[model samples]
Target: MPQNDRHKEREIPIEFDFYNTLESLPVDNRCTIIMISCGSTTVKINEHIQTVTAPAVLCISQYDNFQCLERTHLSAKVFHFDPWYIKACLNFENLDDSVPIDKQYVYDRNMLYMFTKHHGYFQGIFNLTPQQYIRLNELMLMIGAETYAQSDDYWTCRIRRMLRQALNCIYDIYVDQCKLNFYELSENSNPVTICTDYIHANYRNNISLNFLCELVHLNRTTLNQRFKQQLNCTCIEYLLHYRLKISQELLSNTNLKIDDIANQCGFKYGSYFNRQFTKYLGISPSEFRKNPTGYSVKESRGKP
Candidate 1:
């Protein structure tokens, strides 16, 4: 396979392969792994074992011990990429390296944070619906084809775009599954659930840690700890992020003035809102509103 080196850095740290090509389980390094089952198989990541039937997906993070315990009539497609590749593709920073507990699928943490204010982690396995399975399979096939395409001026760019699309599909499925699982697991009392609901419902008004503590009947210290434990973020962080989300929606979907948007999204001052928006998204509200699609890293870097 040919590799592309740009500015002395690898343009894309990615590999595509088939399950039957494996002679042994490869040691995990800096790469993230995506495997789709073509038939029933049992695999172990760290100490957790999962059975994946045909059309199922499994995502393995860097440094996790993985083993295929049982395979019968197994054929699969696999994709591997490093964190830098993901960061370049998604235009985000400080991405989490921790492997989610759920083995059924993997998703981008930042995308999930933007929507849910939670690290994209979940317990239990997910089985894709028939439609989802078909869609993901088709995406993986496209990625596999691009991975081996003849090298050209746009080869790397094409692969990156396909990979990003595949990641987005997985993320959409993850979000839907997480929503259903959250309700099922919490029965409506999960700390993360309660806090997220409250933030979404009350982001237009000021929210404080003490107020959340009072509402949830937990002390300030306990509330912070549990919130972090469940969501991988502090309650206050979640509140700020949720408010920013609302602001972004307004910026994209409404002609509301910046000051009004800030106030409606719980920011006391528009200047503070602008600062936070720039800090988080690397783009000002005005810039994003003018060309929302240009906010992506690809655009910032002058790539397609």
Candidate 2:
């Protein structure tokens, strides 16, 4: 079989729901796509208010703290996905790399991955046209149906197809409607946003303090100072914690081996990963993986 045609079987991290009202965000704090099929509502996301109307689409991520401030006759289809899902679906089951250069054109609107970076960043909400509403609604129905049924091994691929279509439709309208600030990004970019965004996107990569300093155009001390002033931690500290955060997620949410988890989270060695995890969280990786808790490394500082 051709390499392009060969697909590895695995789980896809996406969810679908029908909501009479979006009283709350997606369960487990996953990223979500809210398709407002009817009525209208206004929501406050991270203190920024935006109104979403019928035949409209809104996307939010785990970081988006949103509340429904007002609503009228709101009914919707909700699609929630893991950050890894966008990568998984697009790459046809390969989870490691972002789109390879050769395979970039394989998926339309590969921007779906970019759209999910930060909650409400890159313009996640859109008002759909009547025709778009009809088409997207049909795709949603197909997605919802397939998600519940899981009729075959190819189920996820089918759902991914519909999802890509839906996101593409949203992107078409979103591009024309929202004046995205890509052109003037340099002016708007900040040290914190730049560094944090890079960490989030490339946590899996082999990253270093020097590389980060060069990437953000800052020296070690100045970068650490900026991070401390705003975030209360140095850049390297933030990267370590971010990797641990992801490792914690994989420990609890996935069945991957501890060694694999370590590698995936960018730890050079399994022993080093275990030592850091134990030192910070007060438990070995294997111990935590076996009997995991919602342990916050900074909050509870793990069990005694």
Each prediction's Cα lDDT score?
Answer: 0.61, 0.69
Give the candidate number with the greatest lDDT. Answer: 2
Those runs of model 2 whose alpha carbons end farther than 4 Å from true positions after fitting are 1-11, 26-29, 89-110, 117-123, 178-304
**Candidate 1 Cα lDDT to native:** 0.61
lDDT of 2 by residue, 1-304 (tens): 0011113444456767777467667345365788899877766666444456688888776555767766767888988766444454343233224545346544542455434444323436666789988999999999888887777767777887787777778766655544655423533246666677666656777878887776556799999898888777778888888899899999999999999999999899999999999988888888888788745576533210
Looking at candidate 2, the ten consecutive residues that score lowest on lDDT are 1-10
TM-score of each predicted structure versus truth: 0.47, 0.47
lDDT of 2 at 270: 94
The regions of model 1 sitting more than 4 angstroms off are 1-11, 20-33, 89-93, 97-125, 182-304
Clashes of each: 0, 0
